[model samples]
Target: MHSKIELIDMSKKNPGEPGIEIIESPEALAGQINKAEVFFLKNRKVVLGIGGAILVAIVGFAGYRFYIDGQEGTAQNALASVVYDFEADSLQKALNGAGGNEGLLSIADNYKGTDASNLASFYAGVALLKQGKYDDAISRLQSFSSSDLLIHARAQSLIGDAYLEKNQPAEAISYYQKAADYEKNEYFTPVYLMKLALAQEKANQPADAVASYKRVVDEFPLSSEVVNAKKYMGLLEGQVGK
Candidate 1:
């Protein structure tokens, strides 16, 4: 009986804050110099302290990047088969290992802080979820992050699903809301809102459920989820009306 169990971009071209803030020209350089003269005259110590901190940060970041690149290369090698195993639905092999190859869990731990390790954490969580290891799934999923909005939201949403399966509707509702809030887009926003509404309903929060469903209906009118969102909103609103 499948009732309402429905579940869940940064553009590379635009470099965002880093690109915009970077000093790129002589005219911009003159503006910065004038501002710096004013600022440095008033707060020389503060300025020096900030400059020192930034230098240290730059050095530390460079070192960390060098370290992680090597680690990620090795981890990627170890992870080549594990990712395929996971995608191929060979769940146990994805977690445990196969044919003398390391698994997602091992790559995550052995290559901590690398990009590959972060992906391993996500894959490991997903594998654990499929195997019904709900607690472990939540733990692993919570540790993973990505610059990609969809992946991050999906990881949080997967944690919600794990908690729901564990009969923890309150926790599920929390993560579902987090997922919905993590990325507000036409694609994933309504989908997560529907999940959030279901979790709210499960937790007996009719008002919240109604509000979430109404958000999907109003904000994402053309979404595939909006029809179900309207249906659920009406059901909850009727309950409140009664």
Candidate 2:
């Protein structure tokens, strides 16, 4: 599943120290300035040392940001090159590049802190899942983190899908529930709720499955999933009653 790439803004300025003392007159202001000068003269060596360290820190931070920004661009380009393979269903080539292009795995491994690296994890996981490598898919998906609600919820749902493929319905239920509950909305929540219900049914929790399905029908009546949810809910409710 493709998602919008979101770049994290790390730029921030240090806030100035609070609580300024007011000077009632020019004399008082001059006196404060003189006292500051005298104090600086007394602590000249220490002040210079602290100032030098702060300057070094600022320069180092700026340089690191520049380096990471460049790395992020490179990683993004590499990722874009491989994503075509992914979209074309060339799962192997997508995961492990071909013909001089770096693959999703290489981008993820080579550029650790870049946003593209994080997105590579998601792409790699989906490719692994398509390849039927459930365990590896789970690991790759777990490594991904996103602040976007839709993407994060989709990742959780994909994890649930991997677990379900492995026949671990209980684990699938947990992740599906997480996906269903995360930033609940009409567009995605009902879909996740249906998955949660199916996983619950597979786990032999008839009552819980019924509840999950009923949520889709009642809470998301306008959703496309509601018809199927209602059908499943009726079936499970009858079983629960029996």
Candidate 3:
């Protein structure tokens, strides 16, 4: 009987087999390293330039942040000096400054990007409103922005007050609605809603006024403005019925 023997094929080992390994010769490995070195040398200038640019950008941003921090501190100090004038109702002195201290207008105009400058705009707006400069008040108030929920809503409400003083009930209604709707909560929403209803009434929108007032009464029953809202709503309902 003839015996049959099968030889293992080392060159054609299955690539997917678990234990299969391809070992590179020293010459092949050296050639790959040489190619990588050549590529790095060829693009050395480009790589260095990109790295330099990233370093410069990071340094420049850090410097800018440092400068802004210094400016904010200065602005807050300047703003603090004028707060007493504003609180005491010395509107002109607050707006224009007294002695050597900077005023609201200067802080707002000079500081520009600082938080104190933004607060100066708010204070200046209210000062202008008290002075009966409604247009100027609106301009300053519109320029002021805040992330504080209560303060931001108060700014919107103040703009409505400015428009109301200007005898523009339509404009007043729009701003009042914005105040009432912005970040609605129990503490301030009722006050804004009351203003909105008053603006609606001024604009001859009795139904809208009643609805706004009803919202204050129903949505914020515990609010200080709730009693006024209920009284206004009842009056509006009677007026609408007539």
Candidate 4:
């Protein structure tokens, strides 16, 4: 059984032919307009909320950038005397302080996230190493960061030297390898390779030591380390032959 459908005759006679009006009444049109207005008002609130969040993020980033710039300036000024002390071979004064000025330790602590602070970490680590504070040196050196490849490489090598002084040949070899591979250059590569070879030898890895030395001799022929690398490689190979 199907349901019946009804059709209403809305046509009215105005002349010979009838006409039909399908337009909404004024009251019905006003209702639709009101509904549209209400929808846009709700959406406007949501748009405003997202805009406010973006504004807050922008303001927060601006404040942080300002703070970092200020810290950079302050740290650079504070490190001046510390660098002088370090160059002058006053390792204690470089690490701590001399006279009324602050040293690398204080500067690094005060401006913890600045480039100058990272340099302070490096200076303080080297000062500690010179003072025979191997663990402290390692800690300070590891805290330092730099965008400059040469500086980063040197710092890694310095850490290896600290480990060597502590008689930890395995750790020394690890850092030496890191330094060698950190920034491959004619100057630093041969230097770190020599140190890596020496560390391998100290660790009783004669074969590995020989390989590292040969790399320096073959790849960095013009380097000062080449002479020493050739000498050590020959000595180790002879021992291996026996």
Question: Largest TM-score belongs to which candidate?
Answer: 2
Residue pairs in clash, model 2: none
Cα lDDT of model 2 by residue, 1-242, tens digit: 42221222213323443322222234545677899899999999999999999999999999988989999999999999999999999999999999999999999999998999999999999999999999999999999999999999999999999999999999999999999999999999999999999999999999999999889988999999988998888888899894
Computed on alpha carbons, the lDDT of every model, listed in order, comes to 0.87, 0.90, 0.89, 0.86
Q: Total backbone clashes of model 1?
A: 0
- Model 4, span 32-106: residue lDDT tens: 678878877879888778989999999999998899899998889889867988999998888788898898899
> How does candidate 1 score on lDDT?
0.87
TM-score of 1: 0.73
- The better candidate by TM-score, 1 or 3, is 3
TM-score for candidate 2, residues paired by index: 0.78
| Structural similarity to truth (TM-score) of each candidate | 0.73, 0.78, 0.76, 0.77
Better of 2 and 4 by lDDT: 2
How far does residue 149 in candidate 1 sit from its true spot (Å)? 0.9
Candidate 4, residue 53: lDDT: 93
Question: Order the candidates by TM-score, highest first — what do you get?
Answer: 2, 4, 3, 1
What is the per-residue lDDT of model 3 for residues 107-180, given as tens digits with 9 covering 90 to 100? Answer: 99998878999999999999999999999999999999998888999999999999999889899999988888
